[model samples]
Target: MVQTTFKNNAVTLIGNEVKVGDVAPDFTVLANDLSPVSLKDSEGKIRLFSVVPSLDTGVCDAQTRKFNEVAAELGDNVIIYTVSMDLPFAQKRWCGAAGIDAVQTVSDHRDASFGEAYGVHIQHLRLLTRAIFVVDTEGKVAYVEYVPEATDHPNYEAAIEAVKALTK
Candidate 1:
């Protein structure tokens, strides 16, 4: 279990905590159309997993949009996926309303598979803790960030730099 903060209060996160150089755990999440999407499908590409608690909130919305903006410049070899616990329909609606097209939102509300595997599942809230995971083309985790607080934004520059380095 990992320790994180919710509103600055200590909270426990369930599942295994991933680290750089570790192989990413495979998981399935729902696409906006309710189609199943898996990590393995993006094999042989650099991928960024931008995880948020919920998309409707201000910070989460901002976080997703920021990554969406960065996605446009990263080229096709780098895929950015925003994972959250929101339902697929809600995700789709929010994306449309927010004009977020660069990043594909994946719903882990079905079973919290991604959250559990990545050790960002907030035990009390049943939502994912704010985090970022970058995987290399070979499927090894290249970087990880479990934001200390749920409401805070991640180190965007660091994550973006990690992906950019992969393209070099």
Candidate 2:
């Protein structure tokens, strides 16, 4: 399992670790409108998932905002999603306040489906550790970054590059 820490404190992560070239696992998350959204819902598009503990936090907010700003440039074939354990209502409210229309904010609060599927569930905290995953158009994981520190930012450039490659 990949080791993760929040504020230097080790946290147990459940679920199987995902690696590059692996078939992207399908998981259900709630859209801001409370509709169930699965990985298959966005079939044929390169998808980038920005997993975060919570959007209300500093790093998570910045991470989502950064991705939102770049979504348009990523082309119409790529969709960026910011997944969190926050409630759907909370996700909707945060996106509104942050003007995060480019990136879709999905909620895993119902069952941690996305967290467990992607191996980002912070066992004790019930929050997802920071991570980034770029799935190619064919549903293969092109790049995976499980941020060692939950409070830190992910490698935005690498993840973005992965999506750009898939678009080309």
Candidate 3:
């Protein structure tokens, strides 16, 4: 239950706080095809869960694209999941348009599974606050960054560094 804000106004988050060393919470987010995707689907891989409110925004777009590029450089064992409350169709369209193949866009719009599970769900907005979670190959959370402001960008280098740690 981490408290955050959007443009200086308080917003409530609804879920357990995810910390380093904790077993990553399982969540069912929708793929671009509207198929269910969960942590188990990418088991045994280092996962970078980049949670954003919407891909269409400036910060969120930059965040996703940054990970997309990093994902391309990371080896096959590493996978990036971009979770958002946007619909699967929108996510697919945005990814295709932006040429974001390295990162997979997952939708939590249907049920807020990923949002709630990751403790990023905004009480009033029903959108996920900005955050990043790195899960090692063993399914343990290696790092987490819950951005204090919804409109602010996350610490990109720290998140990437965490993923790099898992790869090594």
Candidate 4:
């Protein structure tokens, strides 16, 4: 379990927490098309997992768009995926409305197994904490960033740099 305290308030996360150098655990998530998409599907490609609480928030929306823009520049060697708790239908609508076509958006609504396994599930808030993970071709995590504050943005530049390094 992952424990985080903010301004004297404490929250605990239940389930496995991903860390740098750890082999990313494979999980199935619903894609925008409502089809099952697994982490193994992106094997042999640099994977960028952008985990957000919801697409409805400003920070989450900004993060997704930022990754979408970066993914376009990162080329085909990297596969960028955004994971959220929103429904597949909602994700599809949000992506189309936000003009987010560069990165794939996935939903974890049916079960939070993906979120729980990744240790992004917030027990108290019942939402995921903003986090980012980069997995190499072998499924080993190369980078990880868990935003300390739930309301803040992630380190976008650092994540992009990490992805670039994986390509070279």
Go through the candidates in order and give each one's C-alpha lDDT: 0.93, 0.95, 0.91, 0.86
Best first by lDDT, ranked: 2, 1, 3, 4
What range of 10 consecutive residues in model 4 has the weakest lDDT sum? Answer: 1-10
Give the local distance difference test score of model 4. 0.86
Q: Assess every candidate by TM-score.
A: 0.98, 0.99, 0.97, 0.93
Please list the residue runs of candidate 3 whose C-alpha ends up more than 4 Å from where it truly belongs after superposition: none
Residue 63 local lDDT, model 4: 97
* Cα-lDDT of candidate 2: 0.95
Residue 70 alpha-carbon offset, candidate 2, angstroms: 0.5
TM-score of 1: 0.98
Better of 2 and 3 by TM-score: 2
Error of 3 at 157 (Å): 0.6
Residue-wise C-alpha lDDT for candidate 3, range 136-164, written one tens digit per residue? 99999999999999899999999988888
Query: Model 2, 40-64: lDDT tens per residue?
Result: 9999999999999999999999999
Tens-digit lDDT string for candidate 1 (23-53): 9999999999999999899999899999999
Regions of model 4 farther than 4 Å from truth: 5-9
lDDT tens per residue, model 4, 125-155: 6677778999998899999988777678889
Error (Å) of candidate 1 at residue 85 is 0.4
- Clashes per model (N, Cα, C within 3 A): 0, 0, 0, 0
Give the Å shift of residue 113 in candidate 3.
0.9
- Among all windows of 10 consecutive residues in model 1, the one with the lowest summed lDDT is 1-10
